[model samples]
Target: MGETIRREWRVEGMDCAACVASVTRAVERLPGVSQVEVNLMAERLTVSLAPGASVAAVEQEVAALGYQAAPLPAPDAAGSAAVPGAAGPDRSEAGGHGHAHGGHADDPAEAGKPWWRTGKAMLVWALGGLVGGAYLLSFILPQGQHWLFLAATLLALIPFGRRAIALARAGSPFSIETLMCTAALGAVVIGAAEEAAIVVLLFAVGELLENVAAGRARAGIRALAGLMPRTALRRRADGTTETVPADRLAVGDLVRIRPGDRVPCDGSIEEGRSALDESPVTGESVPVARGPGEAVLAGAINTEGVLHVRVTRAAADNTVARIIRLVEEATASRAPTHRFVEHFSAWWTPGAMLVSALVILLGPLLLGWDWQTGLYRGLAVLLIACPCALVISVPAAMASGLSAGARRGLLVKGGAALEAIGAARTIAFDKTGTLTEGRPRVTRIIAAEGAAETEVLALAAAAEAGSAHPLARAVAAAAAARGIAIPPASGAGAEAGRAVLATVAGRRVAVGSPRYGAEAARGGLGKLAAAMETLQGEGNTVSVVLADGAAIGLLAFRDEPRPDAAAGIAALAALGVRAVMLTGDNARTGAAVGGALGLEVKAGLLPDDKLREIAALRGAGPVVMVGDGINDAPALAAASVGVAMGGGTDVALEAADAAVLKDRVTGVAELMALSRATLANVRQNVAVAVGLKVAFLATTLAGLTGLWPAILADTGASVLVTLNALRLLGWTPRL
Candidate 1:
């Protein structure tokens, strides 16, 4: 049994923010459920539960709250989606549920039909037409036939009247439908039957349009699921091929991809060469070359030659899978602003209701109006106070922004991380692997008296063979390329922040910093001091070799800065964020790379020193640390926010708050632009939602606004905020 499990379901019948609150409450009341998140714009609910919990029980709870919940389809081994259990009826086909005005919603089957052809809409309109025709004829009919107009109003009231009574019994006495029904009944008693029929007709039509707008917003997120391919051609070792699902591919399995085909999985090219369009994965439009030994991401298009790829990750763990998971879980992490809004909205509806009651009871006495006029105006207040737009504003914007960032290869863990990205003032970067290529090449090897250059290189390679450090790998690789045979070393060990020691050919050899070598050699490095200084002055890392307490030789290495490092630094500077470099190398090498990239250099520091630097930077403003090595984990954790490069060590990735999947410093710039855009979008949405409600609420009280205008303003504000939030979904970085 598992400790806990997470499940996602498509939820239907959520017409307003109040419904979101209600469903959340109902599900939380279940026995084993926790961490419920409901996204109204996406119409999805995600829940966490103890192992062995029954999903059906949760779905029943949602059903009892007047909504429908069904498990989402799971991606299968064949690469196609299949329903987790029995697929529930498509909500679109079932029409609107619960108190949906007009007694029906858009039916998927009748979606393209005109208003007159849709069955439920046509019936509602027919009842409305009958009432409308009768009212017009009443102007000319005899007094005896005037009651016929009242009879037509009764027929039109059937659907809403039935639902209003059911909602009252279901304990939602102040629901919008119930309020509309009460207003209509008041109009009939006060001889304003004509106006009452018009009010009901308008409310129904407004709801229909509101539901359609909500559906369109959900389609934006659903489009991402369709980008994955359903099938791939798997190659066997016997020179045979068979069709298989992309998700069934395991590590080391071979898959053949041709021109115009989307790469089936994340893997490395084993044969052939091609130019791939990586826009879907990186959000960059340029094509990249992929030949043998090049790594490729799933969802990239093979635009040019045929390539055989050896899979590197399982289908469920591919880059595309991660992006999808990131988007779905984003809303679970509410921003500070989002949490504030939710807390404020919890009291908004009840407060509005209390205020509406005062308008009904106090208006007639203070303004000297009749009961009908006061009651009619009070109903207008109720309709405008639903808080639907206010409740949805932040989440709709957050979901769009998170999905947009994922598409661009910036994996922000949550809304908090997204917010932090824009607020970062100083970004400290690890010099190696993060700002440079991280591959050092031996430039010069100087042999001491009675020591051969070959002997120095051989000892260094043999000691570094058991290490995984970037510099170690480079030394070993250089020796291998030079056809140098390394002898097996016994009692090999590494000294932290110093050197590696081992016995090679029965001689004790040490390869590390000059200080360590001099101490080990008993201070015999006076002759080679000038030569080491010359190499260090040239921005090369000079490592001294000591053999049996004698200084033997010095090796010099140089690591080149990445091609995009300078440009990325310049972009961050334009955004008003200072770029700082924190490295463990000597000050000379650190200054060289920092000067080249135009950054502030803090060099020759250990991991603890880097942590202190990060803490000091945090005092100026929020700090972001970008690193890709295990040694950088401490600093990455100490910063306000940590960012890890995609190709970095596993420990670094886990320690950081965010990951740049593209392995480029430019991703940092893009993340900043995207987060800033999302924040601005959120502010705009809040202004629109609250601004409209305040303006309309004041207008309704002065008797200038009526039922039709109030409902229109409420529904229209919801549609406007939703459309505004979607702007982030297509936003591109200015750089």
Candidate 2:
């Protein structure tokens, strides 16, 4: 009745609302589907079924949607992802909910009363502590009270220590807990109950602290998990508006963007113009100007305009949706640092027990020794040989480190993958989406011949009033921002190119890019190109606007540069990594954005060209490429290390090796730093564990240690290493 199944999938070429709806409808028609949710933003659809819902059925539905489904991703299996709020829909449901075959998060084995925690686990621990304290007081109170401590210890051991006994019997006998439990039990059998209690209680404390660290690191990730806005004003056939969930909005539906409202979806302005604050999308401080025919995003605030918008894409396919999807997918793929304890369990734990048994049996027989003496030596070996320190060290560090990165808005999927590439000495960047802001902005305006400066501007603005071209939009936006009113343009004539000839404010206006308007002015090409270079040199994208056979204005647009680009690059340099930018934009735009942000810029390269550049960089050392969305997907896959932005497409997110959960690429630096820190701690912890084990083993074999001290040393070192690893919880940089 509780049988469960799951699979992963890839959604291709799903760009907007209609595509998402088409796919969602197709997916919902499958057999045995109890419920289906198409998280279009994630480019992944989830289906929960009652019975008889086959993986094949789901695959067929995906095929019908022009996509393919496959198994879920896996890199580091042991490190648990600190998912927030239902794990953002990917993890399915916890608490006995069965996940797919590859890996499922099951309930903790044994009584999971890890120490350093509160609640049920903590209560169990406190009771055990009370029992031990009571037993100790019995010596001072009544002799019969000793049983109280013994009974409490045995009960606690039954629940939590069952796993320890199983672990001891298992192939890997040198495990951290196996060692602690053996030593604790040895002391108890010898009637030294308090030492054993202390060992188990302290071990639980360390485990509890590690869990808390991990929980804290992932504390606020759920804050934005279900932030999808519900209702929106949709414009319809009679010019009437009705409210609907932004999710229900479809393409070509008119959306009303009232003042002080977020744009419901990506769309073109059908009516009105106003200032919009797009800080959430671009991390920019300035309010941008948007007018009729301009593009507005789903998460942007319309500051002053009453925008009547024709939805270009559905709510689930909007920019905000894509951004959310990108973040989720990127986060899902993270890998944590090496888990030494689990890995060593295959050999180290069992090997320790074998040697302990040999020393007890053979050593006493070979030399003149009594059975009690040999038994005690064997017991001491088992007690002090506990690999708890080594076992707990790596996981504790990894959990805390990963959590810390998340708290700072840098989601490193787990510890392993981070450690794999974060220390690379070379970093590459994709210019359009990674180094520069991905959008073009209007920066300057120029005047052409046969027109006064203001008159030419007004005419250009008017002619471009209804354009969607980047250059035209820039000019119009600039004019609108300055409060210049442009009358309706005359009937457009000759649609041979991107421009139209028209009359505005009773003046003839031919508005378009430089190539659109005929060459009527002298040295026009030279003038335009030169102006473009100058602006480009300063790290701005320049487009020439022409009107009436003359170059009327030089319009510039730059993708918002990352504010922390300079600082992040410097940090990477300090870590001995060189940075370079590769972009598909023209040389000027590329150089401008890069130079402004103090990056090494490589511009005017196609997709293949970017790939070649990456291959070339790898010749020097491993390369980490940071980018966002589709254009960078291929290059990201090809790079030695692919770091995608959380604000990019699922394509890029799926391809990249790592992702920064925040919209900016700066998180990449922070993630790498945390990974390095975690790796360092893992190494340090392992060394401490091994060193202590060797010394204790040698001392015990030489009969220089008693059962009491041996048990304490064995369990105490593990507790120490485990606690030390938890220190990474707060080890983040000042990002």
Best by TM-score: 1
lDDT of 1 at 290: 81
lDDT of 1: 0.75
Looking at model 2, residue 64 earns an lDDT score of 37
lDDT of 1 by residue, 1-735 (tens): 677788988776565565666667667767788988876655678889998788999887665555567678766664534312112333342143322443443343554454345444565567668766777777778573446556766777787676556455545555566666766676677776766666667766655555555545454555554456778899998978889977678788999999999988889999999998877776657788989998988889999999999998777667676566556666557888788888887677678878888888999999887887788777777777777778778877877788777777677767888888888888999988889887888999898888898888998888777887788887888788889999999999878768888998898888888767767776669778899878888988888888787888988989898888999999999999889999887888888889989999998777778888988999998998998846677888888888887642244335577777667888888888888999898899889988988888888889887776777656678778877887777887898
Q: Tell me the tens digit of each residue's lDDT in model 2 across 590-627.
A: 66667666778787676688889999888877777888
Give the winner by lDDT: 1
Q: Candidate 2's C-alpha lDDT?
A: 0.58
Where model 1 places Cα greater than 4 Å from the true spot, the runs are 1-7, 12-19, 39-44, 48-54, 72-207, 366-370, 489-529, 544-552, 629-631, 647-655
Residue 601 lDDT in candidate 2? 77
For candidate 2, the TM-score is 0.58
Runs of candidate 2 exceeding 4 Å displacement: 1-4, 7-156, 160-341, 365-370, 384-392, 441-568, 585-599, 645-655, 659-668, 688-732
RMSD in order of candidates: 4.5, 12.0
